[model samples]
Target: TKRYYHERVLDHYNNPRNIGSFDKKAIDVGTATVGAPACGDVMKIQIKVKDNIVVDVCFKTFGCGSAIASSSLATEWVKGKTLDECLEIKNTDIAKHLSLPPVKMHCSMLAEQAIKRAIYDYKVKHEKLNNSETTTIETIASL
Candidate 1:
């Protein structure tokens, strides 16, 4: 079964940007890992937030081309934006950008979730450091 991938998706997948991890233990970093059980596709998105701005981001995705491209795009979009601005990024935007089919929409959804989760993790961490911050994020199993 042949599936179509947009040129944008191929471009991102073939030359993904910001593909790496951050020190989740750092006070300014937020990390989140999300997965699609049915597809066994997992994506980990990490962000370094300073003054409420996403100063840096990276990702590791274990999935298909679409999933890889989606997370790759997600990282690119979030960086240099405020957390609130990052929230404006909807899965639909990623789907449209990737020209993903309905079946592949889940990939974009995962990316969105990862972004939200990572931001949340950052907030939690910051608050903990201030005696009201801290909420270490969810799974990455081995990260």
Candidate 2:
């Protein structure tokens, strides 16, 4: 029988740091949405970037203790990392940190995917702004 790691998760869940809302105008990337009902979890992860590095991150999670812990850990992992490094944070990493049971593994997956989606949303918007400017310049040059 496996010993419960509830305390591990609780520690993070109860003392989650970097928990707060961010200003959309200052954030390099922002994403918020509900996850699948079948999974019984939802998370919103936002990262603020400066010079291609994540200067801050925050998350609001609803689900099992493991899910909350994963979100808490993910927030810690992403902050102060480059976007590329943040993208590398995996579900397994969170699970390992919390010593989560196999059955609860999906919770970490939800957290991981949610973080990636937020980053993806931010990257898409960043690219669009850059592309728009490039297009405008090209058009003017062709005139």
Candidate 3:
């Protein structure tokens, strides 16, 4: 007997949108790619920024249906959100959205971690740019 939740999972698996990587130039905000060979899973996530908000997102994931669904839902949720807003997203929310089985709950956790890693990468790059500009200004002022 097929369950309703299983049907939903199949829906995402059969037709996952935004399912590929964006070019480095296209991703203004951040990106992260990770893999687990033991589990034969890989995940890639990228965010596009406009006015400091996440205007777009894309992901490529190789894994079970739950993993794909979690990644797909996460990308959708992160779009139109600020960095701070992205941080507020949680694994529980993703799992709840898909009604994920308990055994597969960890997939959502992985998706959440991927999002955090991407956001952190963005912050680090932004700070480095700002610091370099500040240092140049200071040196010019001292001359």
Candidate 4:
């Protein structure tokens, strides 16, 4: 069945932002890959952290337009946010921002999962790389 999509979602789908991947192995980079098995949607969200802030974020999504738009907007919202601030990002917010319907809300949830996972991954890397230098975020999805 067809469903309605918000204009902002269409805009994002048409002109996705930060649509790329980063080197996952980079000390300052955290990569999280998530997927929705039911829909065959896969999303990877990667982030670069400096001083516990998300300086940059990138994403690659292999899914429907909603998933792509959700991820694209997620990247835009996460950039320039502190790790804690990023943590505050919610799927509901993404849904509201894009005006997504209940059925499509999972796409936003995917984005949220990707963001948190990436942050956690970054924290792990940060702990390890504390003694090392810093650098740069990819496909991320959620169920």
Candidate 5:
């Protein structure tokens, strides 16, 4: 049986939006790369967060149409959402949005994982920054 892709999927693949990387060194930026080479799918997602909200996002995917579409859709959905809201974006939702087949379901899963990984990185960096600031303040008070 031949399968057809959803229009949204085809649109995303044909003209993928936010298909590039950002400056990783930026304080507000977070990036994550995830994939299995054996599966022939690699996806990298980057996010810029402000005040606990995702203000921007981008992705680069090296894979099939499904993988590209999934990542593209993920980036679009995550922008303008809070970190917690972004976490709520599930693989199932992505699959449904793209009308992905069971075989391509893993592509959506990869997108979700990428988002989570980026957010985790952002939180870790901010935590370290906060801790450093606190230590500096304590040191100043003791002087």
Candidate 6:
């Protein structure tokens, strides 16, 4: 049997979009690196959120063609979307869009995880900042 890939998947793999990293020190940036132990696939996703919207996104994948394609497509989709919108992106949607084989479904799952992880990291950081601000206000009031 001949292996086949969807045109969109081939296009993404051949010309990946947003394949790089942002400055880790930037407060508006969040990054997540995740690996699929079953397939030895690793992916890193970075998102730049402004006002709760994903203004930019980038990714790097160290895996198969499916993994790279999935991550590339994910980055493109998440950009310019609110975090709530991004969270609605499902692995099944990606797999269906790519016409990925059942064996390659995990690639889409990994891509989804990368996006969620990045968003979670961003939320955690912001929560810490908010907590610190509240603490400082309390201390000033006590003084």
Instruction: State residue 33's C-alpha deviation in candidate 6, in Å.
Output: 0.6
Error of 6 at 79 (Å): 0.7
Model 4 residue 143 CA deviation in Å? 7.4
Poorly placed runs, candidate 4 (over 4 Å): 1-3, 128-143
Instruction: Show the lowest summed lDDT stretch of 10 residues, model 5.
Output: 134-143
- lDDT (Cα atoms) of all candidates against the true structure: 0.87, 0.74, 0.76, 0.85, 0.86, 0.86
Give the per-residue lDDT of model 4 (tens digit) for 1-143.
56577789989999999988888899999999899877989999999988888898899999988899999999999999898788789999999999888889888999999988888788776564432222322233213
Q: Clashes in each model (backbone N, CA, C under 3 Å)?
A: 5, 0, 0, 13, 0, 0
List of clashing residue pairs for candidate 2:
none
Ranking by TM-score: 1, 6, 4, 5, 3, 2
Off by over 4 Å in 1: 1-3, 128-143
lDDT of 3 by residue, 1-143 (tens): 75645666777888876787767554375887766555768788888777779888899898888888888889889988887788789889888888898877778877887787776566556663466545643442332
Clashing pairs in 6: none
Model 2 Cα shift for residue 40 (angstroms): 2.2
lDDT, model 6: 0.86
Candidate 3 or 2, higher lDDT: 3
Question: Per-residue error at 49 for model 2, in Å?
Answer: 0.8
lDDT of 2 at 120: 60
Clashing pairs in 5: none
Structural similarity to truth (TM-score) of each candidate: 0.87, 0.79, 0.79, 0.86, 0.85, 0.86
Tens digit per residue, CA lDDT, model 2, 1-143? 67566677978878986777676555475664446466768877788877888877888887777888888888888888887787688899889888898998888877777666666667667764466545643442332
Winner by lDDT between candidate 6 and candidate 2? 6
Most TM-score-accurate candidate: 1
Least accurate stretch of 10 residues (summed lDDT) in model 6? 134-143
Q: So what's the TM-score on candidate 2?
A: 0.79
